[model samples]
Structures are given as C-alpha cells and as structure tokens.
Target: MKLNKTLSLAVVAGAMMVYSCGGSGSKTETTTSTPAPAPAKEMTPEEKHKDNPDFVNGLALVKQSDCPSCHMVDRKIVGPSYGDVSEKYEITDENVERLASHVINGNVGVWGEIPMPAHPALSKEDAELMVKYVLLLKK
Candidate 1:
C-alpha cells in the first residue's frame, strides 16, 4: 500500500509538470505564428496638400526637423499654430517668401518675444514647402 501511494503521487507530479510545460510551449508557438497588424497609412502628400507644392514640401521639411516638438497644425504651443500662420498669409506670394526665410533664420516678435531658434542649414526649397503648406491652411 505504501509503495502504491508513492507511485501514484509521482505520476501526478509528472503529469502536472508535463501539462504546465505544454501549456507554455503552445503559447510561444501561437505568438510566433501570429504577427501583429500593420499600422494605418497616412494620406498621400499630393492628396493632403492638393497641388500646393510648398505645403507638401514644408511637411516633409518640418518632419525632418525637430519643429513638431513645439508646433502643431491647428493649436498653439511654443509657437503659433500652423493654421494661424497659414490664415495670416494666405494668397500672398510675399508671405510665402517671408515665412520661408523665417524658417531658415527663425522669427521673434511674430508669435511673441519668445524667439524661434534659427535653422540656417535648412535649404531655401525646404523652407518654401513649410511656407506653402501654411498658405494652404489659410484656405
């Protein structure tokens, strides 16, 4: 009777271990077989900007830089919102030129006394994209 009880306990313990290990191993296999879904795609540059080369270009330029750390499309932050600037200078070539220059050089007094830091390394073409995008917002 004593030997039979001991054998029964060992069998139960071995079965528990096998079950636990099997459960965990199957979970790992399921995870390996199933990949997470991909993220949603952003709107195309041309569709979003709609033939406004400057805005499209500007978006690319801004993304390349650290500007979004402080600026947003519709709301205030450390700087004027992109929408406000767009509205302020819509339909004006001069505004495009001026704003583009400001991006490369940075601006003070326009948003406030808190001056934007200059990025002189940013090219004229890249700056123009920002200006164009802002202008589109005006519409």
Candidate 2:
C-alpha cells in the first residue's frame, strides 16, 4: 500500500509538471515577421485632405498613378510611407520642385539600397500634385 501510494503521488506530480509546462505534446516555435513601424498618429479622413485643394485632387492621382503598389499612406511597403517622405522635406517651393523632379526622373539612395523606378509617364504638373499630396501628410 505504501509503494502504490508513492507511485500514484509521483505520477500525479509528473502530470502536474507536464500540465504546468504547457501540455502541447509537440513544441511549436513560431517566429512571426516583425512588421514595419507604424505612424505616430491616428488619421481621420479629413486629416488626409486638410484644406489643400491640390492635395485632395492629388490623393486621387496617387491611386491612379499606382503609388500604393509600393508606398502606403502611413507604413512602409516596398517604398517608404508618405508620412516618412513628408518628414524628409520641409514645406517650401524649392523642396516641392525637388520632390517633383524626383517623382518624374526617379531617385536612388534617398530611401535605401534599392532604387525607385523612374515615372516617365508622370507629367511635371502631376508630379507636383503628388508631391503636394505627400507633403500634406505631415500634420
């Protein structure tokens, strides 16, 4: 009787240990990919447009121009976020021109090791519009 009681207690303790350690018979070491950094602020639909008429129009142009295929409004995709780009430049005529030029001719080294493809089809006016739209995301 004593030996049987000791064996039973050992079995119960062993089972408790196993249960405490997570009783999933097989260990699954799952590693999830770390997502890119999120934007610092919450965005309302109104925040996207603000008071800029050009940016409002250019927001539509951004979709038509296939910008979202690489860039998102907030987070990183293949390219940096529009918010990230907005953070890169200050509001000024010269900065706008530079951004427009980059959109038309394509720029390398600004983003990362990968180069941005040249948007030859994008007109100068449209490029300016897109730049303005991107810059509007700052606030």
lDDT of 1 by residue, 1-139 (tens): 9999999999999989988778546554534466778888777534766666666666777877888987888898999887787677765778777887988898899878989889898888777777676667653
- Model 1 bad stretches (over 4 Å): 1-48
Q: What lDDT tens digits, residue by residue, belong to model 2 across residues 98-133?
A: 989988888888898777889998898888988888
In model 2, the Cα lDDT at residue 22 comes to 78
> Considering every candidate listed, which one attains the maximal TM-score?
2
lDDT at 43 for candidate 1? Answer: 70
Query: Which one wins on lDDT?
Result: 2
Count clashes in each candidate, considering only residues at least 3 apart in sequence or on different chains: 4, 0
What are the TM-scores, per candidate, against the unseen true structure?
A: 0.60, 0.64
